[model samples]
Target: MDVPFGKPPVERADAARNREALLCTARAMIAELGTEKVTMDGLAERAGLGKGTVFRRFGTRAGIFRALLDAEEQRFQAAVLSGAPPLGPGADPVDRLIAYGRERTHFLLARQDIARAAVERKGPVPAGGPVFTQPHIGMLLKQARLGLPDPETLAFQLTSALEGPPLVFLSMDRSTAEQRAERCQGDLGALLADSWQTLIERLAGR
Candidate 1:
């Protein structure tokens, strides 16, 4: 008899508590001092955890931001899974796709800092954007019945299109960071949302 061999071991309760405390402390430090000022030593000191614990939990500084981004992604995914109509459920597949694209565009743009910071300088670049992107898009495409030959491939391409540009943009922080952030929330968001709506509508044969 063969047993399953790939399950991740559960975190011990004390370990989970330490992780929670560290993440909470990191967030406050980031808010007060910005992402650039956060360091492993700083985080460990603030959380009252040892440096070894921090190093063990997150092997590199990028891991800290990655962990934070992972938590935020979970919350965002939860909203997509069970929050409300259009983005959540009870809407046409085409509508949901459009809404998801719009929301995802803003989500990536707004969190560009954390997303960028999550990248390890020496590690291979991540592809297809964040978790759930391809699968979610594929499900919506299939439900929409677009008559496309390769929805799976299209999903992968679309995920890169939606997430790659913003995170990789050099212009993202060229000018005033505050101004850039404001525009992202306002005009830039509107433009991206409208563009996504147009793309989805055309694909749906609207």
Candidate 2:
């Protein structure tokens, strides 16, 4: 089968060996140090590979971070999409969305460094289209019976509010990170709910 990135396909044997070595070395380094300390040069030395080879495999520090974040995001998505109530399939939409935001806030707080790096160094290509949060926010608004004049615009606004404050606060002392995240999540959830209610009332009056 053809690869998506225009690279020639690797033979199965070579690919397996390379994958195993890379995973083993990366895990050992991460265990000894931490994700932030796993530099390209350090990883290269540990894996017995050239610096260029390490870069070729992962692109950049952010790329490696994203690879790790991708795993976490997948787990989060699965829980929100399928696992349980409030966060998954068995709750009302508002509850599900609130749960989603709360979980996201907790995750981002825990992985602040990785989250910041991912946001700063976005993927080489945009994932879908001009608006990133439209689908998610639109679904929530629809379920809440919120008739937003422009779902796309409202979605972007809500997403920004949800992600911005905690990131700013988290850059400070580590002692207050959890407290700040909890407060931010509560405030954000309230703002979103109130905003939707006001929009609905205004539309109803018109």
Candidate 3:
């Protein structure tokens, strides 16, 4: 498949191979050393390529991290959306919502280091950003039939309640951590469920 560009098709094939090699090496480095240690020079050396090649493939270290975060987000999405009951289907909406938050808390705790590394060098975090789970939160709220004056705003608040506090308290002893997370999930879920029920009743009256 010869591209119309002045260079021969072999050049394009070589370029694609180099790009693949760089991305593969970068992924390996990130998995091994975490995101913080993944630099263009390091990736280049690991890939047996050059720094220029790395930059050409990913544009910046942030770009590489973005790709990594994309992979993480996909895994999270699949787990929450399709993996199993409670987090997925086969449960009542409120129960599922509570389970989702609890599971997300656990996921974040497990992947805290990679997550921290991914966000360390951020500017404006991208909309529907790979690192943030805002989409999942919104989807759950929508499925729960939570009609908010502003769905997006409510989703942010709910997700904050789930993610923000646990990340703060994750350093506690295991028992304490579990207790706090359970309390947060239960309290928040109860509050939101009540609000959602009220909203539905009010809408019905109309």
Find the candidate with the highest TM-score and give its number. Answer: 1
Per-residue lDDT of model 1, residues 1-206, tens digit only: 65455333344667788888888999999889988899999998888888999999999999999898888888889999898988998899999999999998888777767766777875655443556988999999999899999999999888877776665552345355557657677667677778889988998899
- Tell me the deviation in Å of residue 4 in model 2: 18
- For candidate 2, the 10 contiguous residues with the lowest summed lDDT are 123-132
Listed in order, each prediction's TM-score against the native is 0.81, 0.60, 0.55
Worst 10 residues of 1 by lDDT: 2-11
Query: Which candidate comes out best when scored by lDDT?
Result: 1
Backbone clash tally (model 3) = 0
Clashing pairs in 1: none
RMSD, one per candidate, in order? 4.8, 6.9, 7.8
Candidate 1 ranges with C-alpha deviation above 4 Å: 1-11, 128-131, 170-186
lDDT tens string, model 2, 51-97? 88778777877666666666667777777667988877778766655
How much is 58 displaced in model 2, in angstroms? 1.3
How many steric overlaps does candidate 2 have? 0
Between candidates 1 and 3, the one scoring higher on TM-score is 1
- Residue-pair clashes per candidate: 0, 0, 0
Off by over 4 Å in 2: 1-28, 45-52, 116-134, 146-151, 169-206
